[model samples]
Target: MQVIATAGHVDHGKSTLVRALTGMEPDRWAEERRRGMTIDLGFAWTTLGAETVAFVDVPGHERFVTNMLAGIGPVPAAMIVVAADEGWMPQSAEHLAALDALGVRHGLLVVTRADLEDPSAATELAQAEIEQTSLGRIEAVAVSAVTGRGLPELRGALARLVAGLPPGQPGPVRLWVDRSFTIKGSGTVVTGTLAAGALRTGDELDLTGVAKPVRVRGLQSLGRSVGEVHAPARVAVNLRGVDKDTITRGAALLTPGRFLLSDLVDVRVHGDPVAGLPATLTLHLGSAAVPVRVRPLGADTARLRLGRALPLRIGDRALLRDPGRHHVAGGVTVLDVVPPGLTRRGAAAARALVLEQLDGVPDVAGELRRRKLIRGSELARTGVDTATFPAPVAGEWLADPAHWAVLQDRLRDEVERHAKENPLEPGAPVEALRHRLGLPDRALVEALVRAPLVTRGGRVSAGGPAVPGDLIRAVETAFEGLGPFAAPEANRLAELGLGPRQLGAAVRAGLVVQLAAGVVLRAGAPEQAVRRLAGLPQPFTLSEARQALDTSRRVAVPLLGLLDSTGVTQRGDDDRRTVVRG
Candidate 1:
């Protein structure tokens, strides 16, 4: 099924034409029929040449232009009505401008009320006006809903118009609710034009501004219940978990996590110059009419601060209207949903320069280049296909190749600098490096480690300048002179010239381990002590381990603490120590 909206001036026979084609009243309210004018949106459908076509009859009065915009925002095709006697009218031009702003291309120009006057002049004039907009040159038909003159030709033209429409591809569902109400037995139902994707009966969807997701209890298309309905169709969804009073027009049922709700957006202006637009204007997109504050960045680009967060994407076309003046300022193509803040001086100008290069299309490579780094899920939320881009540096963390290379170089330099600054502890902690680099995840830092730089035991280091063999040998010879647990005193180490730097080098080289200040032991002394303590008994006191190792109290305390820290021994609350066998 395909949906089309009717656009024309008030009393131009738009509803009459729809009723004549579908053999059903397009207006639902008795007041509308009694007044002979459409005040709200109405729906009617008919089968045309083996294809189901749905008509969203919109109000053509200038006062209800907002309602008219809501009706045509999601419909891809339109039937622009022009009365033969009236020729062209104000609402006719306004609706046409809206369609052009939204980029609606497939439509038919209908000259209604043909019996009142010759429709040739009106058809020619209306066709001429449409040729200047996005609709371009389209099929034109003259018809009289009263006498049914040229009705067959109008239907044939509409059939061809619907046939020529591009097939709707399955994608993230964003259904803008035009009407919301309660049914007798059902809880709540929302009717809208399903522009893309498919809706299933049991699918879960996120309703805008609602805390919890709503379930699709049932689905209906063209007044018939269905399990699933595809895009380009008018659908009424029976929703669970939300009340009719809360759900209203302008709220959308969206595929959760697929869209990004943004209050600030960067857009490229079309139709009118940015300088002519007011600072505050109403933005119309989907079925929403939101007030916005505009900050002109360039002649064609600007930043819009919306009153509320909306699920927007790149390349979305919408209109900006001056509600006070009752005129459309211009059309806008969204270039960035999550834009940078313009707080610094000249930042707006710089952003405009960058936005000038964007074409409003979702290009993953372009996005990565601009953002430098972003998560895969965030890129997807912007309507970009992450699969088309290069593989991420870490899990779902995409980085530009050049920027990633720079980060790797920076990481290497930071490690080298850290070693130079603090020779005793050369390696930098992983968390410190992550914070220094402003990386969002520690895994990214781990991925940045290269050949010379290595991460081990939660520290990243470029294995600090290999300890001099002479210094390592000196430390080893000093330890060999004493028992395995007999660490030399600080004064004794001074005699051998084993200062903190020398001891640190020996530790890095695995020749000696510094248990604590002034407590240096051979590399394997902790393990050896654990083995000796394990033979003593199930649990031994620190004094008993000290006696068994034959070491002084200073050496024995740090050694036992080291063993406990390294998981080689467990100390109970009673101050008894036991070797951890496993």
Candidate 2:
């Protein structure tokens, strides 16, 4: 599906052409019909060949130019209507300027009411004027609704235009509300163009700047209910948990927890500021126009203080217009949704330099460094490839590689210092280390703990403390003359400077072999036990193996268990044991 907005001067027969083309009345309100003018956004759609094309009929009156902006902001293509009797006029220029400011490039001109006057000159004039704007060198069709002249060619041109449109924004859904009303049995319903992403029935959406979530009870696209809807289509959503008064024009139903809604936005200056706007100007963003205080940051950067928050992000384009003059001051490219306040000297200029680096494509690495972490959903809109991002910390979050490297080094040093401070204790407590590093995820901490620094039992240790030279020599002297199966008792082991932790460390470091609880032997005890067991019968009972090895069941059971664990022997199910061949 594709949507196209109508743009031109008032009394240009835009609404009349829509009725003639779609066979559906665009003037939905009785007052608008009586006044013979479109006061709000109107809707009409037609099937062109195998394609379905929707038209957003916008009012061209100066007073309703805002309504015109609302109609065209979310749609990609447009049709500029110009009455043949009256060539290009003042409102025509303003509408063209707004479209140019929005960067809308895929649209054509329609010379309506051609029967009243020679439309050849009007068509050429409109085409020449359009050539000066962003929408350069587009098609122009002179059509007369009264006589049905050129209607077929106009329809064909529209179909081709719809086919040539570029893909819309991608990712989680964003639907800007243009019209909100109530149904007798259905509750409040809102309508807008689904600018990006998908919306499904029963999907929860967040209203910008509002904490509570509203659910979609039902969804309709092109005036029909649908199970789900994707981008570049007109959507009507039946909302639950909110009333028509609660949501109005400029409110957006967005993918919850994805967009950053802030009242202050920093942007890069676009085309020249026409009319040199006042301190306050109106900001026109996707279907929403609100007042803001403008502060120039530098030659190409500025800050806008909005009255309420709008769900904005990097690389979004907006129009800065003077509400009183009803003309555009300039266009703004959103560089930051949340910018720091200028409370000190040279801060604004410093921020301006930062914004200068952020041009057509966003500075993703720099943003990640400044903000530390950005949500995975929002990162898709940043125009920066995550695969190219420096040293991302995790899949769900983005972090700068240089920043992560510095943090990794800092943590290693902290752990080393901790080990030095408490030589007798295990490395550092997991919770304490996390606090010291000021990091939230344990995976980040573990990723940096390399080599000699190891994490075991929820604690980080720097190689388990130097091995206490005296204790090592004492253990060696005590076990020198002992037999292979001879073991030291718990009391004797403790006397040799080997408590539970130290004894466990010794076994880990291969200094001693722990055959059983309260009975540890020299390091070569396991091989001696294996060699003695090999001499026994192929399948032997525990008592037979113990007697042959000249050891009690205490040392024999654990030793056999260890041998079996290492594939040295196999324990039978029937109170017997056998050697494992391989």
lDDT of 1 by residue, 64-138 (tens): 999999999999999999999999999999999999888898999999889999988999999999999999999
User: In terms of lDDT, which candidate is strongest?
Assistant: 1
Error of 2 at 319 (Å): 1.6
Query: Can you write out model 2's per-residue Cα lDDT over 35-133, one digit (the tens) per residue?
Result: 999999999999998888889999989999888888888888889999999999888988888888888889989998889999989988899899988
TM agreement with the true structure for every prediction: 0.93, 0.75
lDDT of each: 0.90, 0.81
Q: In candidate 1, residue 370 scores what lDDT? A: 91
Q: Weakest 10 consecutive residues, lDDT, candidate 2?
A: 380-389
Candidate 2, residue 49: how far the Cα is off, in Å: 1.2
In order, how many clashes per candidate? 0, 0
Candidate 1: residue 269 Cα off by (Å): 0.8
Q: How does candidate 1 fare on TM-score?
A: 0.93
Off by over 4 Å in 2: 167-170, 273-277, 340-344, 360-366, 369-395, 416-443, 456-461, 466-582
